[model samples]
Target chain A: MAKILIVDDSRTSRRMLRAILEEMGHEVVAEAVNGEDGFVKYKELNPDLVTLDITMPVLDGIQALSLIKKHDPEAKAVMITAAGQRDKMIKAVKYGAAEFITKPYEKEVVEKILKEVLAL
Target chain B: MIANIIANYLINKGKISLDQYYEFFEELSKVRAKLGLIAVHEGLMTEYQADTVNMLQATMDMKFGDLAVEKGFLTHNQVQELLRKQADPYLSVAQVLENMGIMRLNDLDLLMKKYQVENEMSSSSIEALKSDEIDRIVPLFLPPEADEYVAFATLAFKTLMRCADNNIFPIKGFFAEKLDCQNGALQFVDGDPCLTAGMCGDGNALLGAACKFGQEEFESVNMDALDAIAELLNCICGLYASELSQKRITMELYPPQYDDTIEGVGEYKTLIFPMMLGDKLVNLLICIGEKLEFRYS
Candidate 1:
């Protein structure tokens, strides 16, 4: 089971991701409200996987992802987005985000994506 | 929604007693049948066919008539005919009233005429409302500038019916400077001109939607309830954004935010679409080109 960190402004999204990850036998080690806090948490926890939300108040997922990758090039980060964020998704991919998940998360799809990312 | 509106109008106009209205609604509920069942009864499709369509409906998000047509069990025209034969809620109430000898057919007709006149509804608009077609009825309530958002409102209402509450109906929408509510969820869409959409209601209405969305019972509109509602709003905004993107409009969806103590007036111009979900009242607030601010009461 992989150690995961969830970074999103939405409490609901974090709670839901935690539930899904825990149900799949993965450990959710930490959570952050936005990209800025997320970067600090990533450095402190050094989790195996990180999920970052794109649109946020203090800092955004892409900027945080870039910073994390700069700190550790092998950082496995998955970008979370709502639909119609294709442009941001492309940017995240270019910045070394390992995977993507959309909002109103589907359990099976999320599990499959997480398994794939963790396996890598 | 139409039935409730008509019933309220009748009660207010002294055309029907409140007790009689309740009794009439009770009878109307019993007699009102689904389009699939009506199709079967009208001999347009076999019972097996109707059952097959219903089963497909359970597994798929498509409507019964659309699935039936796709499966070659009924034509588009036949589906329309079946839908016409299905007892409309307004007509069902009127028939119950007539059957109970509480109001004659002529009196019911007169009341309907008065309703249209007082409501300033054209015959076709009244027919559309009676048919309970959200697409047709939504535009009638929107201002000319806000008419562009009718598609979004229609999709929202349809999603509510499919996922949250099937018995909901919309009230007339109006343009306002601000809408004050106790609890609500809001999300912003970034694009050429940003749009803000949110749903707000009192604790009861918020709880009602949250319970339906979460499929869990909640005592009040707490964080969990607000989360469920915010998630629902997120879904709606995502879909709306996707629709806009298809038309070559680039939009970005922000995570949904919820505020429980939101009250007071805002400076942004908003279109307030009020709807009734079961017994609860909820409002969808839309603002285009400006950020929304709330004032607490």
Candidate 2:
């Protein structure tokens, strides 16, 4: 299983993601509430995967992803978006997000994406 | 101003501490009550019935109107009227000015009519006003797109109040009802061990209220509960759609439809999931693209 770092501002969302990732046998290395912390965590823990939520306060997922990639060109990050955020998702993809997810999660779809990203 | 009035009233009556008053005021600002009150005033239910339910809601683990309706104290139509009666008390320009000690009642009355004309509000809508509950009406005014989630949930919660014995106020968002279950959707938030699935069959959206919240207590079987469940579906969709605004994919919600039989099955798996809200049992189902069925808490 891949080591993962979760980032988002909502306590509820963070709690939910931690439980699911742990259940899937993935090690949750760290968590951050926004993009700045996410960058710091990525630099420190260097987890195999980072799940970055886009609409957080301070720096957002896009900025965080770019910073992480700049630090390590091969860094893998997954972008989390709300439903109508298609525009942001495209931008994240261009910045080299490994994959994408939507909120109010669906388990299998998440696992499938995680597996796919890990394989890559 | 309404928040201040509520806080002041509660404080003067010694019902809430100063700190609690501030907290309640903050909470009141976040709470949306307009649409639910409109539902009540539009011949939905009697003021007494809604008040009684609202009172019952505050103390016991009981819902407001649902208990009254179940006891045969009020009809569905009456309850719906009561919902409309719960309109925003703060938005009445005259009342706001009067309450602030700036205007007299007669002057306020004349202003109400003129303001109504300027805003194109019907006389009937004005007549539907219940002066005592104005605080409840103003907050429901969200941008148009945001109204879908609020309307669906408000309606669902009102229905639950009319039907159940429990009371739970919505605390967070009127999350839009639409969702995009793209890969890795579950990584953002966590709660409950859940089965994941999806379906793509044509389904109906709810009518009447803005948002819906579903809770099942002790497996009590009520056929009408199906309507409640459907309303919850609408809330989920609205929240999902709202979250996707950043992606620029706008989703239009279709009205809810209902038929008697459960005849068709699709490629998606079906699982019954549970969500815990205090003592409430929240059963949720996830369907993807008309194929897989999954349980979600």
Candidate 3:
């Protein structure tokens, strides 16, 4: 199992993603509220993977993912999106998001994405 | 219907045990049972009419639609519509599998069509449900299950996962004439079929969920908290409407409203799906064919 950092504005989403990550036997190293917070946590925690929610109040997921990737070009990211956020999804892919997951969360898809991303 | 045909074919070829055969049909009937409830809920038949037909089914060896029609409970056209519901088993299951990101779209559709062709079942009926002809977000058979009244479970589960802690679990859905709610938010799913969807709760549970959703600690369940819940509902409902649009169904979403004044929510046949968000309980209500009425509105 790998370590993970969850970044989303909604506390509810963070809890849910944490629950799923932990259930998959991955350690949740840290959690952050927004993109800036997420980037800071990413550098501090140095987890194997970071899951980012695309929309946030301050400094959204894309900006955060970009910051982390700039800091460490090898950084792996998974973008979380609501359906029909195709434009944001394309941007996430451009910024080097390893994969994408859509909400509301489906456990099986989350597991598969993690497995493929971490190769574990 | 596709599931049964394949299961029977495999059993006849000695591929699966007779035990597996019975298990398959037992599970198949569970899916079919929801059709009867949906028929009643859709006003295609009365509860008494559905029940009498179900009772006759055991002794008569007749199909459900034929039996209902023979008893003068439904017209031939109504039975055809019900058959459309029967044709949806594979597509319903496929939607779940697709949502899980495990299967390609139309894989199950093609597979079921092949099975229907082999069994000499009506392929046109299957296509009718899948065609531009039927355009609704919630199909005759819904995802996670076939019952329309219970279909909100998927949305409720998603809402809680997005706005509340993941430890929350849903209680089985049931028909409630009225619900006592101190704080509530509701929005109408207008157009095509007039309906209402809302969230209602009081005390710790609603407040806790609202706090997480809003990222704030609230002392009581107020309009602010209700507004947060309403916003979550609105977001998902918009996505749901978007999905329906792809199917060519036009739906109207009204502005979500929250009220602390209503003592209760009721009117029409309200389908309530209760959930335990940690230690507190909240209810997700959906009223089909009519708008929800608030007590003391």
Candidate 4:
């Protein structure tokens, strides 16, 4: 089981992630609405993993990922993207994002990638 | 669309074997409605006139409509009307079934007449509906075996109305093989119960949904506007997936496809629910059990 933080601008996304994580026996330590809030939550929660949506009103995912990595190089992070955001995936990788999950994501794939990141 | 109805009836009556049924649609898939036939069908021209125009095109380098216009057999407006009718799936299916000798044209017409009469129920039901009563309107458009999708479709209509246009309204849904539109977005869910959903429109029809949901005034429907449309689909898919997940039916979204000139081809029947958004029309299409080949664009 892992301690996870989900940060997304969409309420739907936050709730869905929380449900999936809880069902998988992992604990969702916190949920944040955007990247700036996500960064603040990471500092406070010190969770095992964080999932950040790539776009948000304040301090988008890539920017927040940079801050989280600088704060903890070993942080396990997954970046959520919609289509046409493939170009940004390369940038997220450079910023040390562990994996990428696109929207309308399948459960098996998301679980596999997140587990792989946790194992690392 | 009529083909499926007749096909199902034939199966239930044991008029055709299962193998024959599959073979019929296999042949039906090869059928494409031609302009000359449609012109004759619409009584805009005679069989003799269409034949003459086809022969003239062999000696000249012009489109059928253009040559027909040159020959004064059809006006330019009439040709444009024929071109639009060329995409009609009903005509294609009827032509194929007639050529295959499976059913007589007269019998097919009678079946269609009966189908249309039964279908008047939904249209007459619509007349009783008050404006702002979309909840009562949504179910009338869904196809059979769509109970799971009722809430999904309802939320989609509500979201588009609240976030994009206040006065958007959906017409009755019908089956079509394909839809041609200027631009749009679509996403799919793959799980125990698969699903496909999409929206598209021509010209400035989609501009309202794009700008209002995006919260940006796009002068025209551009890439930025399309991206916003994709995001809106993602948002809807996310909500739907969550609801289904609670039922122990896990669902996940495939990437949303969007761009200029989306062409969707449904493997089965594609149900299109037309909506009046702004001054133009936008289409909402949903298919169950299989991915439309983009199995739709």
Work out the TM-score per prediction.
0.74, 0.37, 0.44, 0.45
* Candidate 1 stretches greater than 4 Å from native: B1-118, B214-217, B255-257
Write down the lDDT of every candidate, Cα atoms only.
0.81, 0.50, 0.68, 0.73
**How accurate locally is residue A11 in candidate 3, as Cα lDDT from 0 to 100?**
54
Judge candidate 3 against the unseen true structure and give its global Cα lDDT, from 0 to 1.
0.68
Candidate 2: Cα lDDT at B246: 42
DockQ-based ranking? 1, 2, 3, 4
The worst-scoring run of ten residues by lDDT in candidate 2 chain A lies at A8-17
Can you tell me the DockQ of model 4? Answer: 0.04
Per-residue lDDT for B99-143 in model 1, tens only? 677774447668778878987879998878777677887787666
**Backbone collision tally, model 3:** 0
Which lDDT value does model 3 have at B270?
80
Better of 2 and 3 by lDDT: 3
Supply candidate 3's per-residue lDDT for B240.
63
Per-residue lDDT over A1-120 for candidate 1, one digit per residue giving the tens place of the 0 to 100 score: 899999987776787788899999999999998899999999999999999988777889999999999988999999988777778888999999999998778899899999999889
lDDT of 3 by residue, B43-89 (tens): 78776777788798889988888888788888888877766765455
Highest-scoring model, lDDT: 1
Interface RMSD of 2: 9.4
The better candidate by DockQ, 1 or 4, is: 1
